[model samples]
Target chain A: MLKQVLAAGLMSALVAATAQAQTPPILKMTVIATLSGPQASLGEQVRDGFALAVEQRGGKLGGLPVEVTVMDDELKPDVAVTKIRGLLESSHQDFVVGPVFSVVMAAIFKPVTSAGVFLISPNAGLSTFAGKACSKDLFVTSYQNDQPHSVSGEFATTQGYKRAFIIAPNYQAGRDALTGFKSRYKGEVVSEDYVPLNQMDMQSEIAKIAAAKPDVVFVFLPGGLGINFVKQYRQAGLTNIPVLSTFTVDESTLPAEGDAAIGFYSGTNWAPNMDTPANKAFVAAFEKKFNYVPATYAAQSFDTAMLIDSAVKAAGLDHDRLRTALEKADFASVRGSFKFGVNHYPIQDFYLAQVAKRPDGKLQTEIRSKVLTADVDPYAAECKMQ
Target chain B: MTLLVVQALNGFQLGMLLFLIAAGLTLVFGVMNFVNLAHGVQYMLGAYLGVMFARIAGGFWSGLILASLAAGAFGLVLERLIFRHLYARSELDQVLATFGVIITLNEGVRLVWGSAPLELPMPDALSHSFQLMDGLRYPVYRVALAVTGLVVAGLLALVVNGTRAGMLIRAGASNQEMVSALGVDIGRLFRMVFGVGAMLAGFAGVLAAPLVSVEPNMGDNLLILAFVVIVIGGTGSIRGAFLAALIVGLVDTLGRSMITDFAHAVLSGPASSRVGPALASMLIYLVMAAVLAVRPAGLFPLRS
Candidate 1:
């Protein structure tokens, strides 16, 4: 009876070993974002880009299969904190991406960093994270909040605009944009306005801005608010005054502004018109898959996937090794050359572009010139990251 | 001084647009006692319809008329099929049902128009800037909007105060059961009121479309402001809605523009930069709260 019992135990051990050998190793990834509200389009674009990249890489990262799960924070910061915690503790995801808005990113900062999961930001580079609170686990592929605004301010100042009016929605990004612009712009600021985040009416404010008689207007209204501002600004006869902006005049907003956007100036970290071979390939692949041109948000998301793929390849998908490899910067991005600053935020280029009519009669934007190249963000010096 | 005048006119024009939307919301609530959250969706429908009509008809005026008519007809069908069932239900139930309608409509718009903002161009005649005074120029379309809103407001006042149908509506607001028992077809009256309310909201939307990008959730933000207007003015009075809407529009626009400068005068630049926007946004909410505290049923409540 003792011999028979020993034999059965040996057989049971062998069977368990065989089953374990057949089970594939999991590379867990989590996509956390604001899935509802006005910014849903941004989230959807990011998601599609990431999915397309994953499929192109054959659903594998560095030859190891990956499992991706997406969660919506509903644009609420408190909800984002809890959701990130749940993803780390229960889901055991090795990497977490997003919480698209800067406010939401700030909310989830501690939970995500302390948990030691790789936090990859495809968009929303909050300044605070690029400062004293920086973490090695947190990496941002997106432009720093101040990057585009700073370049835009420089361009406007160079254009001989001695006095400018600044307008933005009353939100974290809005405040940052104005601050970023003022930091670089030596010109006199005549007036500053902060409209409600979703304000649709701007007649009174437009009147006040006209009264101020600023040589140029710099506005940072994003998404639907951007569209509304551009349309109303044109109708209020503010079009003749050069309008300089960051988020207000992107491809995502150009369609809505239509002909009103023509002749306006904008600055961005990335554009579809970039002449890099990688960019051309990315645009072709994205257009073939989605049937529409990829916006800046989509490009950032796709680059994030490539970044992960490079890290995985370099480190063979082992969680600790992959994290270290990502931190060491193993990827070549479509944005030409980008390296993480000590704060894990990108040090990259920003371009000044103009909204113009294309040969096809559609209103589109063209990159006029590079405003800042390989620019290190202002907050980087404040970061004490090892 | 000319710039200030232009700004004030702009504020007044915006107020007029808000009044158009609030007027309809108040009428439906006052007469039918229904909290129709989907009223904003009706406005969105009007904008979308306007775009569609413009694409088909190839002219702005023709598109505006057809879109308004289509939106009114759509409202009638919704009243018969959905809203009529909830008149006897609780306000919460009506709110939930209307919210569902909003989601469906918002998503439906995305499916139909894609997730891009549609641009509606003004006619060539209205595109140019007209000088108001001393080199201050404003868009002609905005001036036209102000005039149109005033005319509509006048017609609304005349219909509510002078016509037989107006008397029935007043009586219905005062006592619905009495109007129903007086051998009147209350169902037809409710349907007509809903339709008219929808038409007014849609007309405002179409008029505003050329000036603003027509996008999903365009009505949602406006709807909140309109509710604030109705709550401050009183639920049933058109005059109250108009006054409150103008007040809200002016305060909101002026406060946002000047708050930073005002704060800078009292505090350091850094402090003002930090506190200005936050304080400016809180001002409107504070006004709404103060008004509510003084008059729990609103500044002017229609008898219900």
Candidate 2:
């Protein structure tokens, strides 16, 4: 009787081993996003855009079944570090995607990459990471922090604006914006002002702008600051002077900005009205599924998923093999004509977008014209990536 | 000169809004001896309520009135349910408890209103800009906001200084035990003060909503400024709060507008451009520190 019982256990073990060998290994993923607070909508776009790609793939990426865990960073760097430390100890993930804020990105990048796991930032490509600090394990699907602003700077020059007024919040990102704008525009900056970060009031600043009387105004205020600035700018009767910005008037803030953002110009990598089949489908499916227009945050996150899928298919999750495959970036991007620089940041076209009310009564940015063709971040030359 | 005048008007508008918020904060802190850190949440709730009521009523004026009433009612509910219990506790406990209230309400608004900002459209009559000079134009809505704040200030002054309740409130601030012993319903008086204070904050929120983005924690920065106002003005003294608000406002606005130019005169252009705005941010806090050094009890201390 003992011999028969042993024989049955051995047979069962053999059968289970064969079954496991026949099936693909499951991929584990963790998404760290700002899921709460004022910027939650941006994080939601990342979450939803990634989820849509996964759902379309029937819960698999590159012939492997996948399990995804989402952690809310709450837009706090300290909190994100703590959560990431816990994640590293408790569970091993193949990929960590997310963190919409640059502050949170700076916090979580080291912990995730030091653990030998790939960290993909769908948004918030801080210049700090794109330059001398570039890591093979860290990938950014979004443009470097300055690229969009640079697009506006170049566009301003093309529009024959001889003098420009620039303003941004006084922070690292704000300084980056000024540097970016200065790098491209040949025009003279009449005035540059940096207000306190999170300052809701801009009346004094607007008065200064009125007094300066520059041909164009460039601002880098995002989220609620953008809403307040745009509304007040319109109210100040400065519509005659064109306002050029990036991430200031986008799908995320357009609902609150309302008519104030109409005809306002922003620089971006992709807009919903792009004339590509994949982009059109993605936009339609996104709006249908999420009940709101997809922002560039969503588009970049979607491409991040597609990047993973392509890389996994080529190299099958082996650490070095996957790194090589990701560097290749063998996939059709929703933005069209996408490639990675030597530093693993995106090399793509930048467009000038204008906010327009769609026929369906929803406001979205439409592609006005392509401003940059296959632009690479200026910091790519500083990267020593092998 | 025109630029300076426009900036001054901006400062005045900001000052009036600060006054409305500080007025409520001073009354509660002064009369009840309660440190109510959640006072800012009342302003945020006012903005949220204004947005909601505007959507429902389809007009800015109706929304403003309804939101003010609702904010008062909500404040009374909070007072009766959570605050009154902590009134006699230590200041630290009141602070910790009210701070928790801020977190809960901030999260509650995110859950209910979602995290996106909601805007209150400018009323048509006030949407247009009025020319201040040859090239400078100011928004009519902002001018109207200052006027409304002045009117409210006038009414608040009358109620707090001239009426029977005002006398009772002054007595309560100086000595709550004596007022309670003299047969006044101190609990009822506290509740009334709390509600009225909340209503004033809400009124400020409604007025400022069109000019600013109405989102969670929108009141936080202004709350800190309001605290500074009350501290510099002398906590519990309404007149002190009014003067301090204006002083802080004009100083802050003008400082922001002219600091870079001022620095350019004294220093190199590159150094001044970088240092100017940073100095402007520190300007108000520097003023607060200066005031505290001179008068530890604040500009207008209530005799206790």
Candidate 3:
């Protein structure tokens, strides 16, 4: 009954788009995300954020009937590839939004782009694509993977940390993060520990962190890995060492981390507490609809829709026109300011943020200050976009 | 010296958790000749249950007992409803069915809990830290885990060796047909073993909830490790599982920590970074391979 009510509500909401469809039928925008499994929260945020954008636009994009269909990859690469193929075959002219997680996105990159569907990533701006593999067909509304680490590393250096330790899940993104940090941090990296990607328990690694006694600990754990690390780090009696991380302490995992995440310094491109009008509206709308503060994934996804909407207005369903329109980046971003890099990824400000207790006793991130302004990803230089 | 000790202690704590799950698995496999792939979900459920019960009971200790009871009862229900039917089937059939069970339970838990991880708070009494050395301090929760693991192992050994039920279990594991031919109700015995195994796995989950992030599919990775532990420990032998769990845990924990440090000492930073992570993943599988090569039936195969 509830699902039926939701379906009926969705139908009523899509009435404007449906009526507008009489002219040209429907302009479909398929969102591919992990709608199931452990990382479903991230996917849920993207789906909801995108839906909110569409709802605000009254289920239409650029005065055209827009039908948004979300597919669940279920955290499987094969499933994601299949979904992309399905979308390419069916909705060939529309923009495909998201399939988060750098690894999953990397799997379907070639097929989706080759099929001539405009791929807009809501999250996971993989560095591999940002550099040499830059494609003219793809646009990332999100910051490149290395942006946070590089900016945070700059902050670490400014704070005068001479000794540093790096710990991250043993994955491609993990390697990229540590490399990005080292590129900016001119310090003696005392040790580097790369555990398995799925590893949750890290007492041994925590013990090693204490033993090494680095001036600062920079961790690259995302999802549950970050939660375990933060919780155990506090338990290990190393809270004074000042751990810095990216993609770790955000709204999605902050509540679960509870007191452990308080005062934890992180580097991010977006925060819920951003004072910009667009950001404030997005957060307020998200809270009203979902009864929870929007995380970076949701914020970036909303930005993706807003960006796509700008291009759709300039040129409806024309690939070349949309590409040209996107390059102009005429959309009002929730991040206050945004621009496109040579590689088509965001050239945006990265900021230092800290987890703070709200007046209501809930934990949320407060942006401290801008760390890097108009920072294009380091790999943008290597990209010769063909 | 300090680093090594800490790593060893960490390894031991992890091994104890592995043994808790392995103890029940080996018993089920040995006695009923049933391979339960869904066992890891049992552990996952235990963690979730611990969180739920703790929240309700307002104490971790009460939550622990309640979670174990709930897990054990759930296991028995599963055995009666599904597993008993598969006992007469081949291992391949049992494996497929249990794998299905794993998927269903994983999805069910996800539906109930929502994909976000549920945090189980550490009891205030066990939330303190203990000084291991002059400069090194270990979390009191971890010390409690290690101690509880040891105590559980001891109590398990005592029950399996000293009690009549233990003798029946050992007899059944060695030769189920002969034990049944002696006029014992093998059905009842099988139910007991299955329920106890589930309870043990759940207890591990409950203990581990405060340490690891409790979420749906949390047990999937550990399932592989627990299987390796029982295989190395010699299936059907609790003593073997205990020994093997310790070795597997120590090697895994210490390998991840020391291998890179050792590599860096011998090679350049970049070279060590490349070699260390790759080697750490392969380290445990290497041990398992060596063990299988040396003792195909494991180090302490149950006598028939």
* Cα-based TM-score, every candidate: 0.91, 0.96, 0.94
> In model 2, where do residues sit more than 4 Å from their true spots?
A1-18, A21-24
Off by over 4 Å in 3: A1-21, A384-386, B134-136
Q: How many residue pairs clash in each candidate?
A: 0, 0, 0
- Which 10-residue window in model 3 chain B sums to the lowest lDDT? B130-139
Q: On residues A93-142, what C-alpha lDDT tens digit does candidate 1 reach at each position?
A: 77788857888888887887787778899998988888887787889999
Distance from true position, residue B114, model 1, in Å? 3.7
TM-score of 3: 0.94
Per-model CA lDDT versus the true structure: 0.82, 0.91, 0.87
| Model 2 Cα shift for residue A354 (angstroms) | 1.2
Query: After aligning candidate 3 to the native by TM-score, how far in Å is the CA of A228 from where it should be?
Result: 1.1
- Give per-residue CA lDDT, model 3, range B122-174, as digits (tens): 99998989877544568888888988889988988998899999999999999
Whichever of 1 and 3 has more TM-score, that candidate is 3
Q: Candidate 2 chain A — worst ten consecutive residues by lDDT sum?
A: A197-206
Q: Write the per-residue lDDT of candidate 3 for residues A12-119, one digit (tens) a residue.
A: 879968876656746777898998877888999999899999899998877777888789988898889987787678655578888788878898888888888788
* Best DockQ among the predictions, by candidate number: 2
Q: Put down candidate 2 lDDT per residue, B203-281, tens digits, no spaces.
A: 8899899999898988888889999999999988998899899988898999999998888778886788789988999
